[model samples]
Target: MKINYPDGRIFNSQPSKSSLHTTNAKKKLIFGDRGMTLEEEINESNKYYRAHDIAVIYKKPTPIQIVKVDYPKRSKAVIREAYFRQASTTDYNGVYNGYYVDFEAKETKNKNTFPLKNFHQHQIDHLKMCQKQGGICFVIIKYVELKRYFVMPADEIFIHWDAQFDGAKSIQLKDIEKGSIEIKADYNPTLPYINAVQQLIESGKEKK
Candidate 1:
């Protein structure tokens, strides 16, 4: 099974640092803004979907490899160092209306181009595998500096990735304009993504 890394990188499951809610809190304090991290926005949106029974999506837990352990107390063990193992799949996965949903959330500051380096080869492979299984796979990309968001389909990403070495490496904003679903900012869910997913499903149905 695919596992997530503590730093939001997905990897294989291995014993590692005991989860500290305090660490998550610290991360929030440092990164939190009206415009939170793209991951955080997706998380909150998932929570909203759960509460409303719209979909059952979640951010997968991270996998950690604990190297050193200290039994400082009878009740707790402290982990000192760890290295993450390789992940076998994507970051988020779940069922939405009987369809498999798998995707990643990312952010970029550039207004004209979305860099290909933001995505990893392993992640692209994972998404391709998921798509072959008739799953809906996409990325929720946030142009943070422009305050714009787009749900770019995995296939579109793959096309560029496949030709990246040939010099068509970057996903231009104009390209995104043609294929991606532009998401409007919302009050409660912040980055409303379910709407984008719904649009994707609808568009797929139209094609069929």
Candidate 2:
């Protein structure tokens, strides 16, 4: 199978089983292959949101350039080599309550702080640009070790991001708690982040 990207790049969809095994092995060794990482949870939550007519958010697939392919049989083909063509804007984006919604989902094993290195300069700029265009932009951060999550506004994240040059490399857990909205994990939608988004929208109205 071949998948096409919006930029007109095409990639082979089939990956070798050996590659999958190796990737899963690495994940198991590092994160115990829990099969429920932050990305997966958010993806499931998006599916729920779409199903219930709540929102229409989706994870953006990374575009890749396929350089080499192997055809072992007449009916089978596999991708042998591939590389990223460029950096991605963010993890998720879509429409919610007539607002353009954009955000990135990130998780940290550190319990006390989230390292600023987890974010990229391009992502920060993208959020800033989106906010300027009247879009709701934020980041969903998960403290993996502590089993906690927060929906942090992009403005708050920018504050900490700018502080990096002043010798601040990470945001303290306490600061995150003070500046962000905590979200309770649930079974139905997994992360249920849309509720926090609703609160953010209402809070913005109150300020206005």
Candidate 3:
């Protein structure tokens, strides 16, 4: 199936963020042995959370605008054309321990930096707004080359986003190490990110 926007542009496919996705005649990403993409790992973790009553997080589904459909059979209809109904905000959002948790997940092959270009201005703005309303907002960045994960607070992301105007196009790994909580990719809950969320909540209290 293919989807195209009304403006004559194809909107069905997107670049793969998985470690298994090859690129530029080089090894693109890293997933060690599990071979799971960042999003897959997070989804598995979310399921674990829901089953144990730890958190109620979920991937936000993007609504599609249907443009064409074909009745291939009386019992079946095939969607031939569609587009995203609107620009979506974050990837996931829900309640965790009485606090609103909102975040985006990104994977990068860069070993020393996470490119700011991975994010859009609308996402930054949405996270900022969520943070303002007392939500635990952040980004979960997967460094595919290094096979590391970090839960970075939204404030750090804003700082780097604002600095892009001054020529900073990416956030340094060292800065992320300092300002974020690193979580090991583990079992049962593959990401174990909520622990980092607890850290963010505690760190916020310290700031107050």
Candidate 4:
């Protein structure tokens, strides 16, 4: 299999396998290539949405300050020193169906829990602000080892986040299953998170 990037880069997908070279140890290892990372899948999904006029969402680019640069050649320049200007608010934000949408994408290898440390304080605060302003704020989390994905509302996430000070540093998988909507993976939009968003919207309306 081959994946072509927007920048015209082609990546060939190879079967990843490992073997133990011993007389007694003849175990065949199989590596699962779950296609793309959470970020890449979200980006591709956003692109598909934008192309189909469904929504306009994009990844927020982090601001960086380049202090030193060297012109290694006439055609190419090398960056020597650069620093982040500031922390970013969220991973993605835009408008969809006349409603503001804001979200962050995260992935964890742990199957039992999703750590609160994966998120920043400022990001949580930003999500809270967005929710207060009637924006649809949520988080897309992927459990790599389990091959599962979920879309959790920001308000629900805050409960577990605030509980961290009480010694709970992570949200248990069972808790996530109870609070979030599982997004089915696809090939066209990759993540198809909008389905989960629609479910969230309908649930909110029902609650009201």
Better of 1 and 3 by lDDT: 3
lDDT of 2 at 167: 99
What CA root-mean-square deviation does each model show from the true structure?
7.1, 7.5, 8.8, 7.5
TM-scores for all candidates: the values are 0.81, 0.80, 0.81, 0.80
Candidate whose lDDT is highest: 3
The candidate with the higher TM-score, 1 or 4, is 1
Model 4 misplaced regions, further than 4 Å: 1-33, 69-79
Q: Rank the candidates by TM-score, best first.
A: 3, 1, 2, 4
Looking at model 4, residue 158 earns an lDDT score of 95
Model 3 C-alpha lDDT per residue in residues 39-148, reported as the tens digit of each score? 76787688779878999998776567899999976578989998766555898899999999999999898999888999999899999999999999999999997999
List model 4 lDDT by residue over 59-93, tens digit each. Answer: 77656799999997556888899976656598689
Model 2 bad stretches (over 4 Å): 1-35, 69-78
Candidate 2 lDDT score relative to the true structure: 0.80
Q: Candidate 4 at 39: error in angstroms?
A: 0.5
The whole-model C-alpha lDDT of candidate 3 against the native structure comes to: 0.81
Which runs in model 1 stand beyond 4 Å of their true positions? 1-33
lDDT of 3 at 164: 96
Q: Write the per-residue lDDT of candidate 2 for residues 1-208, one digit (tens) a residue.
A: 2211112111222232233545553343233225456775676577668878999998776667999999997678999999866555876899998988999998898989899999999999999999899888999999888889999999999999999999999999999999999997776577889988988888888988
Q: Lowest lDDT 10-mer window, candidate 3?
A: 3-12
Superposition error at 141 for model 2 (Å): 0.6
> What's model 2's TM-score?
0.80
Top candidate by TM-score: 3
